[model samples]
Target: MSNLLPEEAEEKLVTVCRTAVGDSLRSLTYFNRFDYVQVYLREDLEQEADLNSFIGNEWHDFKMTQDAYRGSELGDYEYTIRVFENGYLVRITVEDFGVFVTTDGISMQDFEALAAATTEILDEWAIEE
Candidate 1:
């Protein structure tokens, strides 16, 4: 794993995601000094009308738990994919940050491949990661 900066990672993610999702992607934002990339999508009919929507109805169920000092939810309906290269981390949240997926200990190429695959699954929306 090469030591990649957050900006570089963000660029790679955006490219991979764009190739995956095409024009529906809304925004990909970096938070905590690039520790995470919040991937937001437009709430359009294409997204809402899918019976098998990857991002499910529990989109707004995320909440910060005081006991665990973390966020928790109950379904995999929403999707979030987090990517990490070198030691930096990037989190891609889906549907109002509903689902959270985190990835670490991987090469840049592998990370890009993963992002591409995920984008492919989310073909209904555009991604700006």
Candidate 2:
């Protein structure tokens, strides 16, 4: 139940991401087929703690989706958040919000931070039209 339409929400999300991850952001891709937003980071960046936080949000959503007993609060939400030595991969779907962020040189802590930041940004975005 977001106040904004799907397209508006998507645009706001892209703006928020760009504002929050300015210099480190390498590219932004929006997949119309799946309504996915992809944010790629620079290869030389280092923000493991931030990135880890971001992944944690995805994990939370994943767990919610896996819980059969829980009501459909997430609504067709599904995701994959993977981290490795060189980079990390994230694919998420929550209602009309689907985002994928792939980055290089991420650590456990960084991933979590990134997830956390994204969650915060989305929360703020959700409040607006």
Candidate 3:
């Protein structure tokens, strides 16, 4: 069903996240330009299955960020964390594919770890340039 990573690969990705922080992870949604798949952990997925549509604007925003901050003194892009009243949303992306995960309150160290793990996996599965 996924155009970027296969089911087994998707499972592995989620497993890695689970292992990293255990039950804190609520859901992970993998998305590209056209399609997406949501793997729920702590909550049942609601009626909306359109993860790509939900994040459509974010994709554009991320691209703008990459272009706007090119060559800045700041180091490489790592992760974006959006705080919600109930939990946290963490997004990690590369040039082609990316994933956003929801988790119960987690520490900054855990956030960095998730971002690193995600980026490594993304490199492994990225399309050949």
Give TM-scores for every candidate, taking all chains together and pairing residue i with residue i: 0.29, 0.44, 0.87
lDDT of each: 0.38, 0.50, 0.79
Task: Tell me the number of clashing residue pairs for each predicted model.
Answer: 7, 24, 0
lDDT of 3 by residue, 27-110 (tens): 888877776777554655454545656679657777888888888899767678889998888888888778888888999989
Model 2's TM-score against the true structure: 0.44
Between candidates 2 and 3, the lDDT winner: 3
For candidate 3, what's the RMSD? 2.1
Q: Candidate 2: list runs displaced more than 4 Å.
A: 1-34, 37-80, 83-86
Clashes of 2: 24
lDDT for model 2, please: 0.50
Minimum summed lDDT over a 10-residue window in model 1 is located at 57-66
Q: Write the per-residue lDDT of candidate 1 for residues 1-129, one digit (tens) a residue.
A: 223234555455556655544443444433221133344433441333232232232232222222233345653332333333423223344432322223325455654554546545333333543
Top-lDDT candidate index = 3
| Reference-based lDDT, residue 65, model 2 | 61
